[model samples]
Target: MEKGIIFDIRHFSTHDGPGIRTTVFFKGCPLRCIWCHNPESQKLEPEAINRTKKLDGQEFEVKEILGRYISTDEVIKEIETQVSIFDESNGGVTFSGGEPLMQPRFLLELLKRCREHDIHTAVDTCGFAAPELFRSILPYTNLFLYDLKIIKSDKHKYYTAQPNEIILNNLSMLNQLGASVMVRVPLIPGITDDEENLLAIKEIVKGNNSIKRLDLLPYHHMAKDKYRRLNLPFELEDLEAYKNERLKEIELMFSDLEMPISIGG
Candidate 1:
């Protein structure tokens, strides 16, 4: 009985994948993307987040613990409760993170259980895991919400605290394996949204037939408060969210690729 630490289990999430989904956000991550929205999920162990909220006219402070260690069977039971909803909307389970691949064995077992019950499964990954670990779950995954931040190796390392080599290599391998993947680009202002980076990303997806679609996700400030609660610095505090016109312009750049392109998720 293997158990893994999880920070959150977001139920009925539509933005993560097709249909309704229960996104199991596994704790722990490899990259330290400065703009990460879920700062609490970055750590592998459970952590207490101190928060203050105003009620009536007084401000009260509380310590909220994030992350729970649960076995595969426990997770499966929760998924089974939503089985009817999944059947109704072609939705199932989505393994997200910090990085689900961080806990390969736990993720593998969860995916296997999903398959045994005929659930449609999706893996929302940063694509920074070992090739062998990724290959092991291929047979159980129906769709992959793959993320591609910065294409340049140096810039990627500077922003994410990890090189792009492993991420790119893993994506290319996913294509070669004929896996169904949707390339999700986090349109961070000035970083990933620059024309130079967009073109580089285009170069990588230009001939990848295995890729089903591309999604451009604009940056948001929702994580600002999360950082405050966790006592972590919000690096992109001065940056503004992407405007509609700017997002439209980026979407047009990928038009020539002849692949379906969508803005946001």
Candidate 2:
């Protein structure tokens, strides 16, 4: 039995994929995005996160475990409980991260098991993995929630610790292979939401017909407290979430692409 570190499992999630979904948030990531909301998920190993609460003007702290090492069978058992709901709603399981590809073998096992169980599956990826590793799981993945951040190489490396070369290459290959991919662009203010980045993304989508949809995920400061819980700095603390008007404006940029465009998730 292969065990992997998972930070969280979100059930009844509509934003992760079509219909309702159970999103398994795998721990660890290769790239360090500045505006990352789940700071606790970034680490590969199990760690403790501090949680503080104020009750009647008194502060109390509790330690919460961020990661849990569970086998593939263990996960499948939990997912099995929702099999009926998944069938009724056209929804299934979604492997999200901290880059699920970071735990390739473990993820592959789960995908295989999901296929055996006759469940529709989805993967929310950062698109920063080897082409072979990515393609290996394609047959099992029904939909891909692919993340496309900064298009420019320098800017990509500046925001995320890793370069975008591999990410772009893998995406192109996925397109060439005829995969169902929905490009998810994180609209981080001052970082990923700039005009140059949006235009570049437009060109990328314009060239790739494999892209089924383009979802503009507006930036939010809701994860600021998560950073505080992990004792990590929230760089985007001063930045405000994107207004609906601005997100619609960004959506207009892709109107010429002739693909389904949505603003959230």
Candidate 3:
């Protein structure tokens, strides 16, 4: 049986996809982006972390396990429970991660099962997988929430610990395959929101019909506490989210693109 390590299964999520979605967060990733929001999703195995809890005005630490392995059948059963919700809202299941591609077989199995139940399937990915892996899951995936950050190779490697070549190539391949993709960019204050990087991204999506939308997600400090609990460093600890004025300016940079542009997904 194919089982994938899963950390979370978020139901009634409007941010992950169209309408209300049930997002299955797979555990594991290949890249190490310094500004990752879900730091807990990076590890492939189940692990314990210290979480601070408060009760009756007193604070204490609590130990919590973060990930688990579950079979496709088990996951499908959960998705089945949301069928009525999916049918009414045109929403369905989203396989998110660390990076869903890290557990290709497990993700593929879940996607196949979702298709069998007539559930709309989307994969939220970092595009750091082999070409063949994308091809294998293409048929099963109805939409892709693709993340692209820092186009320059050196900067990309420095921040994400991975090259942008594979990411860019796979995106191009998807465009050629006519896959429905919504490119999502993390607008880190100084790292990814620069004029050069935004212009470069604009060029890539300018004429691509496969890319249906572009979501500019501003950086936030919501995961600071999570990092503290996990004993992980928060590199952008002092960084702030983009102001409305600046976001408007950035949005104008891609106004000429054929796809829909929004501030958040």
**What's the TM-score of each model vs. the native?**
0.97, 0.96, 0.97
lDDT of 3 by residue, 1-265 (tens): 5988999998999988787899999999998998899988988999898877779999788888999989998899898999999999999999998999999999998898888889999999999999999999999999999998988999999999998999999999999999999999999888999999999998888767789899999886676767876677898788876688999999999898877899977
TM-score between candidate 3 and the true structure: 0.97
| Native-referenced Cα lDDT, model 1 | 0.90
**lDDT of candidate 2 over 76-160, digit per residue (tens):** 9999989888988999999998999999999999999999999999999999998999889999999889999999999899999
| Residue lDDT tens for model 1, 13-112 | 9888888989899999999999998888788999887777768999777888889999999999988999999889889899999999999999999999
Runs of candidate 1 with Cα error greater than 4 angstroms are: none
Give candidate 2's error at residue 248 in angstroms.
2.1
State in Å the error of residue 18, model 2: 0.7
The collision pairs in model 3 are none
Model 2 weakest lDDT span, ten residues long: 225-234
Give the candidates in order of lDDT, highest first: 3, 1, 2
Per-prediction RMSD in angstroms? 1.2, 1.2, 1.1
Q: List the residue pairs that clash in candidate 1.
A: none
Alpha carbon lDDT at 193, candidate 1: 86
lDDT by candidate, in order shown: 0.90, 0.89, 0.90
- What lDDT is reached at residue 118 by model 2? 93
